[model samples]
Target: MGSNAPLNVSAMVVNSLESSGIDHVFLVPGKLIYPLLDAIDNSPLIRGIVGAHETGSAFMADGYARASRKFGVCAGISGPGTMNFVPGMAAAHADRIPMLYIAGGISSHAEGKGAFQDATPGGIFESGVVRSLVTDIVELKNKENTQAEMRRAIEGLNWMRRAQSFISIPVDVQKQDVLPGQEVARQPYAHGEFNACEVPANRAALDALCDQYLFQSKRVAFLVGSRGNDAETAKLLLEVAEGFHIPVATTLSGKGAFPEQHALALGVYGFSSHSRAARVINSDELDVLVVFGSDLNQRDSMNWSRRLTGGKELFIFDDSFDSPAMGHISRQGIFSGISASFRLLAQKAADNPPGLPQALQRRKGWIAEINETPLYDHRFEQLGDRVSSGDEALYPGDVVKHLCRILPKDSNVVVDSGAHRIFMAHYWLSSGKGNYFSSSSLAPMGWAIAAGIGVKLAAPERPCVVVTGDGCMMMHGMEIQTAARYRVKVIYVVLNNAAHGAIHIDAIRSGSISEQFTKLPCHSWSAFASSIGVAARVVERIDELDGVLSEACQYDGPFLIEVITGVFPAPNRYYAEAEACP
Candidate 1:
């Protein structure tokens, strides 16, 4: 038996998070989790952000993690509230973003009973349906070992695995007092305390893999992902790229991993890829393809295009590389940081410096020339006249162009999943100083709306922008109010093409499907933002974009720029791939 001094498990959990350096916790207030919420309220080191919906809350956590480079935290109750975390958590899992979802389950003794929201073995609602989506699920039924279990779970958030973690605490145990308050206040979790994490490959194997696949290759290319964004890793990556005379390209989620303006830079490859990047990666001269911190599962992988990896020797550095069929030099992920330890070993002899391939030189010049003007896809021949006229009355590119042109030097842009994201991804040029993040695979709509709030809260110094579309706004547009309530400064540029942009475009272009289901009422997002206390302006033309964005950039509080544009598809090859799927 333990000391019966007053110590609440909920209170200890909040303290543990604070000690772990988690400053914020997003949640939708629920009865079962009230104790934990109250604990957060009393804590001086942590804050509780009440969200409009659990899904939005989860996404805010995802955004927070991406912005701060720290694991995100969210809370919910079992059953319905827990259910809302699926799409958001799945998105994080797909993007390999680190996050933790804490849910309050029914009483420990209430197992198979008719407890309202029990998720236990024989409960009415078994939340384990999301087991595969999350990295780990822990149900805390034993009250005594709560602190130890909490530490283990928090430490589990290391370099790899996939998605967010689910921690279910029983209601009875949450309120129970089993130890002294002083003992409970102990720091159970710390940001870097658990540094001894498992590396994907042993040092010897990694070196050998690099020797045969990297150093021996005549032409090598680097494809970095989200994990390649850290300062040390990015610096090391640039050094390695220069050291090896390699051209560096990034996955969709890795836009800012390397300075895009560099001579050796190849922009994003995959769905919203640059012709230059697709060409570089798919070239016959390429002998090696090295990927970092990404599974390359999203459009970032061009729907796992065989041509992308067909004849090349592929090397990857991500803790979450689970794709068995694509093949690799090492089945396990190689840490991007390992470049530090292996750089000298893989260095080309100084006397025999490799010259840039003649073909690559031309392709690089070609890409730079293409980027000199506004990126216009020749594939969309139907809209050639409107595209040439520079009328965005149906094009979101104008808005992205204007925003990219005027955005502050240091800004954080969080893009939601939609046609608008494709525009932003395809056109936005990054300097490696600013931050860019998007949920790739399980791209739940409205993720950026809430995620923008989290980004603003996490990186308060930078100008935060959320680029979303009408379909996403309809999903969780009200989350802007959450930003407004906290006085969190963020710019939301909602591209209202009046429909689910991509679906509508694909359906209309395919001619095999009904476009009626893809169309939306084209609701006025500006009016909605004003109704909810977020200042907003509607942009219906290209001329109105520059100044509207300039003023929004200077605005201190949350602002929305609703650009009424068209669903002009990005020059993406996805439509063809999707058509071929059947």
Candidate 2:
């Protein structure tokens, strides 16, 4: 009965993941995915991370990918369990984080017969749940071609980390043994989704960029994005900027893409950006703007304001510009393979050094003004003494400022959505470590609570911290228990405002009738976190906050620090500019 039958569809799928450098698979156990889950549990090379919920698992996979620069993998059963992955999938899609999603599906025999949890094309809801959100979907109905289907799906993800790839295998097909002579996908190969095919720069776009913009433009600036945040690109980018004397600015999603302290840096140009950065990007006098890896969506582009792209020569470079949302934006959309283009430019910088652009030199006074401006000049640190009715509550901005000052310069910080994200992105001075990450496009509520666990798992040597809010903790906060289960050393600092900080502040300021719904229940997060076996502390004073954070950084296990923050004095005006897009 066991004659030459060592591998089945499930085994092959698990092997493919291992060969592709996916050492962990985050998932929630369910009926249909039992075969795959069983294989994952048995695999010696891959660890299965069972989580509290499917979406939390998906977010963990996303964080792992962001931290490791490898493909993230997660799974769920069909229908309900699979549907829970929507928000996380959409977040990964918008941020262009590459991931492989494997989920169970309808049995091959009962696919169109309305089988329970059927995910067939004719089943209930059809594929409407994730049909549009993911990059591509692979449905394996025939066991004979399972490997081929997986290969096709992975190749699509390889093109660019643009979206999550889905693979759904019918329960019947998942249990079937591999056919003869067909590779069972057990044989190891090079990494699958990272196979970088050289996408040569669009010759026409490159010519225009060189001739009209770089050589002849009056003023040029480099606006880098998340895609250009890697190590090699940073150095190459610096080479080109130093060679051509182009001022560099980054989108909010692209923070830490360039050294903020560099003389040529204009800080961030999108949400919570410096005034000089906005002026430099939108100025009519600036001749050309070179954008690498940003989609310039509503948030980054000021809701498609004419001033951003209308008056400047915009050269947009990336792996591809296929987003339909970008259709209205006028510019030369170049498929330049960002790293390749940067390498070429860096080489040119060494061979032929063009003198500094005279136009850039003419703007020296303006550049000097922004450079002279201190990044941490906001005066909110003294607010606790003056405000808060003597409750010993701290401002969220001060919390972020103190964390940035004391947290190890080498640590990786994950910013979750809420008032905390605004303060961190706007006030945290990046030393160009390229370790700061935020899911800006989607901005899901409790992402970092789960994602930071995955981040810790991915980079065990690096100290990881999650900056989140009480409102976010109310959402997927139990994910901290998942961190505790694994003993992931992520220090979660929750700003306990007893309300949705941003909305509450807005209600109080706007005098709006919606204030009734803005307040949240006051609860001791440290107590709850401790009950779940996580080391917990409630910071009651500013003087003690630094010591708490420092201790947590040195701790060997998961920790949570709840800082009771007063929502008032609200991060000053400059750091709240991101609300414009919201």
Name the regions of candidate 2 deviating beyond 4 angstroms: 1-5, 109-116, 121-126, 159-161, 184-195, 202-218, 352-366, 374-391, 569-582
Tens digit of per-residue lDDT, candidate 2, span 173-274: 888888544553445448864544545555566655655656543577888888787556677788778766678888778887777778888877666666
- 1-582 per-residue lDDT for model 1 (tens digits): 134546688987887787767899999988888888888888898888989999999999988888876789999998888888888878887777778889998887777777777667677444567787777777777878877777666765644443457888988889986566444334435776564343334466555654565445356778877766654556666766655556778888778767777767778787777766777787766777777666666465776566677777777655544552334223455553443433432343222434424433544554455455322345542344331123547466656767887997578888998878878877787766538878766778899999988888888988888899889998899999999888889999988777787777667777656878888896888999999899999887788888898889788799999987766756566424633662
- Relative to the true structure, candidate 2 has a C-alpha RMSD (angstroms) of 3.7
Compared to the true structure, candidate 1 yields what TM-score? 0.86
lDDT per model vs. reference:
0.73, 0.77
Worst 10 residues of 2 by lDDT: 380-389
